[model samples]
Target: MLNVNFYEHIDDTLLKFAVIVSKSNGKWVFCKHRERTTYECPGGHRELEEDIITTAKRELYEETGATTYTLEEVCVYSVSDGINESFGMLFYADITEFGQLPESEIERIELFDQLPDKLTYQDIHPILINKINSFLKVKGILNNIELKDNIIPDISDLIDLYNDVGWSNYTKNIDMLKLAYDNSLRIVSLWDVNKLIGIIRVVGDGYSIIYIQDLIILTEYQKQGLGSMLMNYVLNAYKDVYQKVLLTENQTSTVKFYESCGFVSNDKYNCVAFVQFKM
Candidate 1:
């Protein structure tokens, strides 16, 4: 994504940014700081090994400690920080609930639904405001996103899904072993009225980090964007809520697929053994 022509006007450009936008207290909420103004979203630096949304979540909590909120991905834009820092991705999030701003946020924080009158122009950049506004207008997704409480069914058709779909290749194996052992594994199943369509198994300490052991989807259920959903459900159910979701797979397609679901490579980390041989 680098072009000499683009950097000609800026020097030593480094850093990408994302913003979290929310509506709480019956009003629109934007974070204000020495960082940026013009009613910007809440987000900060991209860390060494962190994914974008994770960075956003960490930043929001560190700055505000307001854990109760719904997050949505709006868009990403690149820009210069006006210093040596440049080329940032700004993401928008909507916070439906508001909590008291921590003391650390007082001097650096200002929240507003509408543009402040005669607001100090220093922290907020004009171009950044323009970018946020443009995105908000086009996407126009306010009030459409509602809180969802996932409803889980008792008898899922997920088993039949594998038998009918190609992903059944692995899921069928899983079904055969279902009654054999519990083995401290948490097998979350998703199904419809007729059959089992998707499945994933997670095993770990059940506290710090959980490893995704198996993920199977009926081939017929593929390409409908369910893989990401299943991964995300597992992640939130374990990783985000618990701080770590780790899985190892040899397939390039699997890696790419999970990456899109917010998995990143840890060079310091590698598979000890996808399979352990009987000694």
Candidate 2:
């Protein structure tokens, strides 16, 4: 219910920028500058006549003293801190090439703050942000566009839809989607404004337990923390009605994802599933 575009409302033009995060021993390399006392990712404004990637690289070199490595845009954030009109894009860089820390204009450096910074997407929760996420195939949180609902642009045609395509093979194609879309089921789709980016299907009797099936989100959209958003919606919407929302995920990279979404694994034996396919 807060203003997300706090800067744009007054500035008329939103500011553009970039940031870089360098992971090191035990703590990440961060810098503090200007009036901001909190340590932030290393990067700054995009100079006129500049592109995004280049801005990220220049910022990286200036802050961390790491001149060589690969960088990727992890997430973009609105830099409307309080009344500030500046916007920033947070980049996650894998520093394959390591070097010494350079002397940056910013002096203070801190490591691992327990709480998310002022730069987080939810730092300034724009009213009805959920409506915006529900309508796009790919929506930028930084864009702040609102929407109602959009399953997919051409959902009927896409064959290997889920990032985990192998999972879909276990079930029929139409059945898979149908389960996700079943209004009778409390299944829901996650959209980035109007296009569907991922979906979560809830199955089970409403009383005893509800199983969370298939929280499939695209690889490109994974790190944005949409999974957590989906789970929050489910939990808050049905916390009183449902006693437990259980899910079974494979023991791979997915296990951690589930854990972060408020699932706890047990050391108790006899915890496994059997799917006897009728071959």
Candidate 3:
């Protein structure tokens, strides 16, 4: 089985290619190669000294004849099977116009709301499309995401969100958690229609510092940039504060995720953080 991993960032030294998952109106866009009957997203390998964004744009135009569109970065992704690891950037595009298809390896372009069965990389295409949709929802690319400040969500949803992420300790102390939420300096909750999907709460003076206490998305809703979205909302809301901080378990992936949001390791800045535990 191919191993696929998603990242917030990675160096060029490990990247192998880029993929652009595009949509026009509200339908998905895919390309067919001249020698292949199966469909695939518009993508290709990087050229010498070419930036990855340019690679995605070039491949999208060459494959689908996209003439007018806006693109957004989704995330970095990697795949491997114990032999060699391959890295790529994931991108999403909203195409508004198309020109005549170029005379290239592409045979044709197709748009769909429901994907066709015959895809070039059958094992990978579907997963990539899902990731793209998640990107859309999280980044508000094709969906309306409502943000509520100081709005309290349903207790059940909050419990589910915390429990889904293995933070049952918070769930077990739901009363205390609710009290804390009620007193937070600010609360940012993200919603899809009426569903409580993501949330971030900040505490501290509105001017001096803002400490993020809880930032969560339901387990089934992770990896689509929802976490980053929540972080961005709080960071921007308190951009002028001298101290913006959070403390979480020291795991590699978790640390990387936070770092992507303009945060640095305390050690990197020659500062130290101390935490005390009560037994």
Instruction: Pick the lDDT winner.
Output: 3
Better of 2 and 3 by TM-score: 3
- Candidate 1 lDDT over 1-279, as tens digits, reads 221101111111243654555445645455555444444445677888667678778777666555677665543344434443244444455555446666554234455656555343334444445544655553443223222223332223444554565444445466444542255346665554334556666667778667776666666445334455577777777654453555555674566466667666764366342546333
TM-score of 2: 0.44
For model 2, how many clashes?
A: 9
- Which residue pairs in candidate 2 have backbone atoms (N, alpha carbon, C) closer than 3 angstroms, thus clashing? 132-147, 133-191, 135-193, 135-194, 135-195, 136-193, 136-194, 136-195, 137-195
Query: After TM-score superposition, what is the CA distance of residue 263 in candidate 3 from its true location, in Å?
Result: 1.4
lDDT of 3 by residue, 1-279 (tens): 887778876666666698998999999899989999989999999998889999999998999999999998888888788797789998989999999999999999999988888998877778888887766565653276677888888788899788888887788888988898888898888877877888998999979988888888876667777788789878888889998888988886688788778888788879999988542
Best by TM-score: 3
Cα error of candidate 1 at position 69, Å: 29
TM-score of each: 0.37, 0.44, 0.77
- Model 3: colliding residue pairs: none
